[model samples]
Target chain A: MKLSRAVVIVSTCCLLAAAARADEAPLEGQVLVLSAASTTDAVDALRAAFVKTHPQVTVDAGFAASSALAQQIAAGAPADVYLSANERWADFLDEKGLVARRRDLLSNRLVVVVADDSKLEVKRPADLEQQGIDHVALADPTSVPAGIYARQALAELGLWQDLEAKVVSAADVRQAMQLVVSGAAEAAIVYASDAATSDRVRVAVELDESLSEPIRYPVVLLNRGAERPAAVAFYDYLLSAEAADVFRRYGFLVMADDHPAADAVPVAAAQRWWGLSRDEWLALRLSFQVGLCAVVASLPVAIAAGYVLARWQSRAKWVLELVVNLPLVLPPVVTGLLLLFVFSPKGPIGGALAGTLGIEIVFTWLGAAIASAVVSFPLMVRAIRLAFQAVDPRLEMVARSLGAGRADAFFSVTLPLARSGVLAGCVLAFARSLGEFGATIMVAGNIVGETQTIPLAIFSAGNRPGFEAEVWRLASISIVLAALALVASEWLERRHATREST
Target chain B: MNRLSFRCAHRFAGGFALDAAFETDAQVTALFGPSGSGKTSILYMIAGLLRPREGAIALGKQIWLDTRRGIDTRPERRRVGFVLQDHLLFPHLSVERNLTYGLRRRRGENSAIEASRVIEVLELGDLLARYPRNLSGGEKQRVALGRSLLSGPQLLLMDEPLAALDAPLKDRVLSYLERVVEEWHVPTIYVSHNASEVRRLAERVIMLERGRVVHSGSADELLLEGYSPSGDWEA
Candidate 1:
């Protein structure tokens, strides 16, 4: 009896042990790292090293301008780490108590880069004053750290006053580099780290460090709940000797100190009165007005086409489907170019419109919205078609059987069931319209308030000098809006699905 | 004088097809068949919901569909009604709105049917304001029927209207259908498979097997011969 009791006690002990093991299973920690758009390489290099040391942890990294990253972190992203290109963001995080430790772990140098085979003669800072230079790319001095440094260098060289008119603000330093590489701009100011990552652009000159404020990157450990240990581990690993080598290899100078100054600028909260400048607000409101117009404008055509696709069973369906999906498949820039080629003042459609109707689409907000709508129209049709498909054809048939004509049956039955899908499609189209950048920028030049939407504002702000805080503010607002939109769509879809099943 | 009579043929992609030529002087004539034998297509052809490759359909004095003369009437102007296999009631609109849609379509139509008479005939007096979502399967079909009838159509095309209901519900709805046919006296093309239902509801039967009409005879004659169109019939 004692032996049997001992055996039972042992079994119970094993069960308890197994339960304890389950309870003590290794914790899951996700570490988010936000890096400036141009510093993607540096951030990636640092993350790779840190992750090597902590293989159990998952890292979520986003690359945007330092200003945009700061804005996103400020807007309550569950980030565990923020690595900004300059001290401004670290200081902002320090003020909010979001940063575990404000440390200036790295320094970056600013340089002007040009495409390798460019004809533009840009040898020195003063050479930028030369005539015939149509476009010069830079991060907006207001928000991006690299752009701020570039502006300081230009100011020190007395080039800022002369270069203002020729400048085109990009959303981030990386995009600025792209402008130079794509031959869209004559030259762009980017980080030495950024220049090292691309082979298409050649460094024109490294500006004297003394001409600008010292480029310091502050590394902060975010206080994300339930992930504190992993966050701190990743943070500690960043300051380790091995990670410092990676930073140095990537053309960044590791700073001895990592502390945010008490007098650093406030991490600006998202500005909500549509959270845009007068020009940006106008663009946003116009985007809405135009998006609604575009959707309404395309409604008849889309409805007719959608019906043909869904119900007609015509032999020409394949051709129509291809046309409908063409805008989606083509690159935005290509779509913009196609529009430009057709709508340029001298182009065929443009010539007709301008010559006959006294209307033009060149560099116009209407044009931008049209381009946006055309590119996004497929999404609307697809959503609407799905809604129509969900509706039972029998309903219409029943109406006909009751002495209702075909038109009567359609009005009574098929349209109602497709309501939810149509609404969803409209929302999707509207969002796509608001966020459209490339096609809008190409088709409608970044004319402030006239064509500059929030995305364009954020881009230009990132490129503009002394507009960093504003860029952060706008980015934060956009992120919040986008998140809200996603949540709403998800909730709406779930409710509809539940109703359909029940 | 006969108010509604028609003959039509329908062709689809591939060779799978249906051809029918019939005339009905009575209130109801059923085109009975198994599933997917082109019964619905025939109803669609009659209501002008579908166009035929080569056929003629005339309702009273109106030439609805004639391929040779290139005279095809739109479904909205055909003035013929239809009821489908499943009750296709609008979930968004109330029963009253569903009934009024047809009235709105016929705004200039002088002989438009009365809404009150339809409500009374279909026994939907209490359910006029409710939505299709708030209705039973049988109730929805009744509203669908009332809405169609209120459009002032010359004829009705019903494609297995009670196929979705339970046996008890079908019986209850069938009796209401009988009242509609008798009181309205509108010519109807009723499609069904239930032999008993066809016998009770229709005066004549045009039986289709595969895609061709196998028999066209009085309901009693077809029942006695077991609906075989094999002897001395021209190919």
Candidate 2:
């Protein structure tokens, strides 16, 4: 009996030791995770729980629009795991052999949201087209996963064609929600999780699953991190019950082992115009309008500033020059944000204008023009200043001796001599404006047929799956336009030189 | 003819002080001095292009500048024609457009020198359609001279007008200058360091040395007494 008891104790002790070993396997080093912006809060909670059990493991997380993160991964960003808002980006990485393993981690439902104070009755998908719904915001349907899903659901319900005009695209789902909250948009179609985060918006309707492809968040282990034990541990921890509980708390649908199959929804065919789809053409047209308007509106001010910078001799001249060139040296996004502060409805300039003229600028084409103008102003002023400086000051003095007044001499002699530089400045500003995205997106809010310029269109296209052709087309057009502007500017400069030399 | 009386005291940043006074009613009065002797500054002051610290300048009855009275007419209203050393014609305008530039400012007043007469005397008919960038040095100077004449100024100021030209070109341009003085007979202040050019052009000479007037007399007396036989005066 003693031997039998000893044998039992030994076997039980061995089993208990093995169990302890399995639970305490130390995970060391760093695991970098790139996640969708919508899943940031949930991922943070999951990371906290994961580090508690594996104290040696450090979790570093980055969150942005899923499509942008996927692009970054494809460009060889040092990311071990990617949690995409939809399966498309994961599939994109998988097709490129960048994803080592992937699984559907969570599901989310689409909801149409309106301001909490809104009295409009929106019962179904068709209700989006009802009267008083002037503008509907969505994630960029061409590129962003949320917007693609929203576009699919709208197309499935046959309301896309009619409601397309009122749809304004945001860079991401969070931005779409913010659009509704800020009252820049009357309505927004966003993930249920995103809607829950905002108190200003009320969910009007939850879209049925049958209306579009199943909205699934897929967690992926990238090939770069497949060999790292810390990354593998973090990847497994993301799929554990603790992580699922956190996701569920954040209004995400925790996927079961047996989830619904993903159906391949047919993409709607786009109508073509001049070898480009209607939306692409609209973006191109809007880019031209914004570019021309920006150059025309800012030219007089730029010329005057250029003249002062070139000719004025004073201690305060450096300060004027610094102010004029500030936008050039600053990051485009920062410039955009500064412009937003000055041009928002509640902003000083915007408030006075709106109060007196009843004219709003935010989310409008004029806002896009203003953003482009501000960003391109430095380039214009620099070129024009150099041009004016190149003209002989004695020419003006001689004109004065010929009985011409100060203003007369400038108009007749100085302006004619500096015409080439002025023209070159215009072309440069136009090109700069055409490629303006960061600031324009910030102030203008990417409204289709209104503020969606070529760069913005390319950004939207770049974020969508299976829109590679459209992206290439828009990108090529931009390249061609920039090349032509540069060539024309060079030709003008050369002509000016040859004329002076002769 | 209106007599021009000018007296000025000015100090340049380089410590060059100019204190001189003269009066002339001659058709061509020469400001004879070497370069950097404040000759250009005096001519500029007379044209209202430069301001003196204290000065009184009168062309006949009109006061172009008087520091005591605070009467400083603008350069354009002073109607003093200036022929720059470089003949600074508008590079963008055609030769004809450059000649006609000052005509636009002479509205309501009848111009004594007609465009046709100036063009005929300067022989600029062949260069009318050409731009200044295409013109030779002598041609540019002729255009500059004709441009000034057409403005019908009360006085003309020429600052080393032949300084940029070669010796051969200078002789040809000098003949053109002689014709302008003999034909239009405008009261003129001509600046030059070349004594021979002054002898050929000026009735009276104000000799300057280190920014001060050392002598003032007929061109023959000043050039003979102060200048070397080589017709060049050294500062």
**Best-fitting candidate, measured by TM-score?**
2
Candidate that would win on lDDT = 2
Q: Which stretches of candidate 1 lie over 4 Å from their true place?
A: A1-293, A393-413, A464-467, A490-502, B1-6, B107-113, B226-235
Assess candidate 1 and give its lDDT.
0.70
TM-score of chain A of each: 0.52, 0.52
Write model 2 residue lDDT over B104-164, tens digit each, in one string.
7785666678899899999999999999888999999999999988878888999999989
**Winning candidate number (DockQ):** 2
lDDT of 2 by residue, A1-502 (tens): 3323533554465456435433644324667788887775678678878889877776766556899778756644457899999998998899999888899999899999998898889888788888889899998899899999999999999999999999998878877876776678889999887766555678899999888899999999998679898999899988987776667667788788453323212232232323898668879977877787788778889999999999997889999999999999899889977877777767888778778986657656778889999999999999899999989998898888888888988888887788888888888999999999989876775544556799887776554323557878899999999999999988877777677643
Model 2: lDDT equals: 0.83
CAPRI category for model 1: incorrect
Indicate the residue-level lDDT of B203 in model 2.
90
Worst 10 residues of 1 chain B by lDDT: B226-235
Chain B vs. true chain B: TM-score for each candidate?
0.89, 0.97
lDDT for each residue of candidate 1 in B62-160, tens digit (9 for 90 to 100):
787788899987667776667776666666677898787666666365553578888887889999888777888899889878877877777778889
lDDT of 1 by residue, A1-502 (tens): 3323533554465456435433643434556666666656556557666667667765546566777666645644345677888887788877877766757787777888888787777778888777757778888777878778888899999989889888898878878887886678888888776677666678888888898999887777776622568778777877887777666666666677353212212112234544455545665565665565566556556656666677867688899999998988888888877786777766788779878986657555567767777887887788777767776676665455444566656655666556556656666766667777777766665544345677877876554323556777777767876676566656655555666431
Which window of ten consecutive residues has the lowest lDDT sum in model 2 chain B?
B226-235
